[model samples]
Structures are given as structure tokens and as C-alpha cells.
Target: MYRERPAGFARAVLWTSTTAAGAAPTRVLPDGCLDLLWSSRGGLLVAGPDRTAYLSGGGPAERWVGLRLPPGTGPAVFGVPAVELRDRRVPLGDLWPARDVARLAERAEAVPAAVLAEVAVARLRAAGGPDPLGARVAAALSAGAGVAATAAETGLDPRALHRRCRHLFGYGPKTLARILRMRRALALARADTPLAEVAARCGFADQAHLTRDVRDLAGVPPTALLPPRPV
Candidate 1:
């Protein structure tokens, strides 16, 4: 199950899961988000923004819970450039001091998913408020704006936007654009939209362009994403 964070951190999300028996590796596609996860057994870990699908391990007894923060928010909460954590899962202890992480874990592990968001909210408030422009930047880019257009809409020049995106999202605006576009495409594809129309609606130059973006960001073709399950 999953729910959006209900408090000050509007872009945050939380979810809980019980792994299924004999499950294949889960294909977690990139959406430019970062996850803070705790297992019933594995304790705490951070899942970074992935360029392509991350194949995660699975088993029946592996219960877990997580909070996901939007692209620019993790840095304020985690105190590191998003680029430094890209495509990796590191122990929370590795980022925070062991003793601090132990203390935080006591709080995190004791309550429901809501408390996890509260912890991040408190940390984020202490670091100053959430990034003022990150949402507008993500919205503009996800809506098919070019990097330059997104910069203009967000009042950032191209280089400035690229630098901020790299720090906050672990990639430049162009890559963020592609990832979000594939996300858009996948949503439409899952709804039974024909690939040609989806490509057109999502602003891909052609079906081939859409196919390449899917391959680049999801590690699959459009047909694979069209079905209810992973290929």
C-alpha cells in the first residue's frame, strides 16, 4: 500500500509491502525520486534515482516500508548531492553517523509510515523549507517542455538549471526530461492507448523515439510496459 505524505512535505510518499513468495526480481523504473526504506529484517537503506529499471531482490518473508521524496527534497533531508548517491543503495548509517542513525531508527521503526514523513519534515524544516522551484521545474519538464523552455518557465538559465538538476536529481534537465517523458508514456501505454497516439500525445517525435526513451529509462520496450506485469 502507498499514500502521499499528508504534511508539509507535499511531494513525499510512503508505502509498505510484504514480498511475495517466488517473486521474480522487481523492475523499479526510474521516476527521478529517492527512497528511504526500512526492512523488517534489513533495517534502513536509501534507494537512489536510477537511470533505468533497478532489479530488486525479493522473497516471501521480506517485509518493508519506505518514504519517497521528490527529486530536490532528498538533499535537504539526507545532506548530500543526489548525484553522489545515484544508482546505489546505501545504509542510512553510511550517510548519518552510526549513533545518530541508531537513534533515528528507533523513532522510524517504532511508528507508522506517517512518522517517517514527520522525521523528514522536521529535518527539511531545519535545513530551510523545501526547494521553492523544484516542483515547477519538474512539472514543466514532465509536461514536455524542452530544457531551455523549462529553464525559462522556472526562471533559470540553461546552465543554472543543469547544475541544479544534477545536484538535486542526479542528472541534468535533459535526462530528467527524458525520464519523465517515459513515465508519461508508460502511464498512457498502461491505459491501453495505442503506441502511435501515446507517442504523439507525449511529444515523442515518432514511435521509434518513444521506443528508445522506454528502452533508455525503463529497460523495456513499449509493449512490455503495456501489459499488467513486467516482461
Candidate 2:
């Protein structure tokens, strides 16, 4: 089973998942976000932003908890540039002191979700909150703005904007825009909108363009990503 709720700080999400024995692997599609994870078996870890889908494995029945930090808020909470952790999962100790992380891991063994939220809220406060630029850039791109237009709207030249995005989102603005657009297309499809209309509404050149883009990022076609229709 899987469920999620807003974390009440920094636009993050608190999610939990539990798998039965021999459960199938989960395909986690890219969405330009980072996660702070706690496992019944693995303790505390961090999940970095991915350029493509990540296939998460399952084994014996176990519980997992995570705080999903929105794009651009990760560096503030994790104390490193997003690019440094891209496409990787590492022990929280690798970034913070082992002694401190170990103590927190012990607490997480009892109430994992609360520990994740406490760590994020504290770090974010110490850092004076997430940078406003992240929200602005993400909003413009999600609203169908082109990369050049987003750059102008954010008041940065193309080169400067790209550099900032790399540090903040672990990729350039163009890649982030592509990921966000793919997410938008999938959401529209889930509403039972026709694929062609989804493609047009999401800024794709056509339905074919949408298919190729989704395949490149998700390693599957749009139809495969969507849930099955009713009988």
C-alpha cells in the first residue's frame, strides 16, 4: 500500500509505502524532486533527483517513509548542491556527521515520518527558507512557458539561468521543463482526456512528439504509464 499527504512545510510531501512479500518493483518516474527516506531495514537515506525513471526493488514485507522535497528546496535542506546527488541514493551520514545521523536514525526507528519532517523543518529554518527563484521558475515552466521565456520571466540571462538551474534542480532549465511537461501530460491523461488533446494542451508538437518524449524520460509509452480504463 502507498499513501501521501502534504508535509506542512516548504511545500514538501510525506509519503509511506509497504510492500507484501514478493511484491513487484515500483517504477518511480522523474519529477525533478528529491526525497529524504527512512526504511524499516535501511535507516536514513536520501533520494536524489533523477534524469530518468528509477526502478525501486522490493523484498520481504517492510515499511518505508519519505519526505518528498519539491524541486529547488533540496539544497537548502540537504546542505549541498542538487547536482552533487543527482541520480543517486546515499546514507544521510555521507553528507552529515555519522554520530549525529546515527542518533537520528535511532529515533526514526520508532516514528520515521515525524523524524523526516523534523529534520527538514529544522534545516530549512536554519537556511532561512527555500529560495523564491525555484518556485517562480517551476511555475513558469509548468504553465507551458518556453525555456527562453522562462529565463526572461525570471530576470536572468540564458546562461545564468541555466547555471542556476543546474545547481538548484540538478539539471538545466530545458530538462526541468521537459520533466514538468511530461508530468502535466500524464495528469491530463489520468482525467480520461484523449491522448491527442493531452499532447496539444501540454505544448507537445503532436501526439507523436509526446510519445517520444515520454519514452525517453520514463522508458515507456504514455499509454503504459496511465492506469487502465474501467471495464
Candidate 3:
């Protein structure tokens, strides 16, 4: 069974099985975004930025895991019983053991799903509100605006900004900046804008920079990912 929780900024979907013994293994792939996954029974095996998955019926305790991807890899495989998860911005991996997640999933059957969603939203709000440095950095990156200037605006030393970002966001400031720029470029490319224009508008140094970033994060060239526009 699948349960959805409202995260406010980003929604979360939870999956669980009634008969844990009958649960099949699952595979989760990269979806070019960041995710925080928790397992109740088992642990998730993450194979680098490109591949990370869970083994269903593996766990029953609450273990939280966070993953951030920079793109550029095909779907990862999870070895177990047959299960597949797919999404453009979010991919699913093998269903492994997760005690906490399983408990939450089971709880959904008792309480209203919306109530659990509200709880998730509250948690996300608490975590996000307590941290300002990461948000400031993320905002600047998402805008494709000045990094140095934004760091200055936050009243943090350039190096300090880097340190805080890595601590709070689990990635370097520069890497986040590149991901944000790449996302902006993707938006433009999807709009049918020319490649050079997309690169320029998204603050990439050039088309090659855009290409490299896309390849690194999405495991495919920008052209390959962008759908052809109707003439």
C-alpha cells in the first residue's frame, strides 16, 4: 500500500505492505532531486549519487536517510522480488526493510491520511524554519543570481557560506549552485528555447557547461531529455 504525506514545500509518498513476509523487493532510482527517506525495519543501500535503493521486508525500525543527487545516471537496479518505481523528478527503488516507514504506513490505515500528511508538513516546517542559511543559499542558486553577492547578503564569509551549506544541505555551495542553474536551464530547454539561449539565460558559462551539468545530473544530454516542441 502507498500512503502520501503532505510536506508543504515538497510532498512525500510512503509505501508499505500489510503482510511483511509477502512484501517484494523494490528498486529506487534517481529523480534529479533531494529526498529524505526513513526505514523502520531495514536500511537503504545507496550506491553513489546515481543509484540508491531499498530492500523490502528488510526492516521495521525508524532510520532516516537523506540523499541528494546531481543527475547523470540511468535507473538503478535493486535485487529482490519484482517491483519497479518510476518518475521524471522522482524515482522509486527496491522495497527493502524499513521499520519506521512500515509503521507509518500501517498507521495510515488507522488515522486519516490527511492527518499524517499534516504531521509531515509540520515536521518539514519545523526543520526548514530552524535553518536560514541553507534557504538563503538555495534561493540564490535557484534564482540563477550572484553567489558571492548573495553570500555577502547573508552576512557570512565566503568560506563560511560554503561550510554552512555543506553542513546543512549535505553538499557544497558550488554544487548546489550548479544544480540550480542546471534546473533553470532545463526549464528553458523544455520551453523550446535555443540551447545557447538557455545556457546564457540560466547563467551557465556556455552551452558546454550546461551540457556537462545536465549529463552529470540527469544521465542524459539536455537535448535527449527535452521533448521536441510541436511545430
Candidate 4:
């Protein structure tokens, strides 16, 4: 089972999931976000922004609660550049002082969602909130803007934009744009829209283009990720 709600702090998401013992691994598609996680068995860990789908480890049944921080927001909360943590999951203890992580872990174990939200709020407040540039770049790209256009909108030259994007998102703007586009296409697909229509609406050149991008990012074809259409 999995559920999520807005964190109400910095556009983050509070989520929880439980896997049955011996269940197949779950595929987690990238969405340009980082997660602070506490599992019933693993204590506290941080999931970095992923460039591709991450397959969860299959193990004994376990419960997980996480705070999913939006792109650019994580550096403020985690005190680390997004690129350093990209495509990796590290224990919170490795990043913070062990003693502090221990106390935080205790609170998280007692009340996972609330504790994670509290920690995020405190950290973001101390850092003066996420960089405003992140929101602008993400909005532009998610709206189907090209990288150069997005850079122009954000008032940054190409190189400067790429540098800032590496610090804010785990990758450059072009990669982020592709990831966001794939997510948009998937949303339309989930609404039962025709594949060709979804491709057209989400800015793909064609259904084949959509299929290739989805497979590259999500590790599966669109049909495998969505429910079968009725006859």
C-alpha cells in the first residue's frame, strides 16, 4: 500500500508505503526530487534525485515513510548539493552527526510523517527557503519550454543555467525537461487518453517518440506502465 499528501512546507510531499514480504520489487520513476526516508527496518535514509527508474529492494515486509522534497528545496534542507547525492541512497547518519541522526531517528520512528515534516520545515527555514530560480526553471520546463528558452526566461546564459541546474536538480535542464515531459505524458495516459493523443498533447513528436522517451526514463513501455484500455 502507498499513500501521499502535500507536506505543506516548501512544496514537499509526505508519503508512506508498505511492501508485502516476498513481493516483487517496485519501480520508482524519477521526478527530479529527493526523499528523506525512514523504514521500519532501515531506520533513516536519504534517496537522491535519480536519472532513471529505481527498483526497490525486495526483502521482508517493511513499512516506509518519506518526505519527498522538490528540486532545489533539498539542498536547503539536506545541506548538500543535489549532484553529490544523485542516483544514490545514503543513511542520514552518514550526512549528519551520528548523535543528531540518532535522536531524529527516534522521533521519526515514533511518528514518521510528522517528524519528517518538522525537520524539513526547520531546515528550510534556517536556509532561508529554496532558491527561487529552481521554481522558475522547473515551471518553464514542465510547461514544455525548451532548455534555451527556459534559460532565457530565467535570465541565465546557457553555461550558467547548466551550472545552476546541476546544483539545484541532479542533472541539467534538458534532462529535467525530458523527465518532466515523460511524467506529463504518463499523467495523460493514466486518464485513459489514447496513446497517440497523449503524445501529441504532451509535446512528443509522435507516439513512437513518446514510447522511446518513456522506455528510457521509466524502464518500461507505456502499455506496461498503464492499465489496459477496454474494447
lDDT of 1 by residue, 41-124 (tens): 778888888888997756656767888888777888888888999999999999989997787678767774766677788888
For candidate 4, write residues 150-200 as lDDT tens digits: 989999999999999999988999999999999989998999899999999
Which pairs, if any, clash in model 2?
none
- Whole-model alpha-carbon lDDT for candidate 4: 0.92
Every model's TM-score: 0.90, 0.98, 0.57, 0.97
lDDT of 3 by residue, 1-231 (tens): 443433333423433333244445433323333333333333232333222222334334233333332221112112211112222122222343466445555554455334344444554455443344545666776776566887888898888877666544444567666666776787788887999999888877899988887877666788876777678
Badly placed stretches (over 4 Å) of model 3 are 1-33, 36-102, 109-116, 124-128
Backbone clash count, each prediction separately:
0, 0, 42, 0
lDDT of 2 at 130: 87
Candidate 1 — worst ten consecutive residues by lDDT sum? 1-10
Lowest-scoring 10 consecutive residues by lDDT in candidate 3? 73-82
Residue 142 of model 2, lDDT score: 89
RMSD of 3: 10.5
Question: Which scores greater on TM-score, model 3 or model 4?
Answer: 4
Weakest 10 consecutive residues of candidate 2 by summed lDDT: 55-64
Please write out the lDDT profile of model 2 over residues 62-145, one tens digit for every residue. Answer: 788999999899999999989999999999999999999999999999999999999999999999998889989989998999
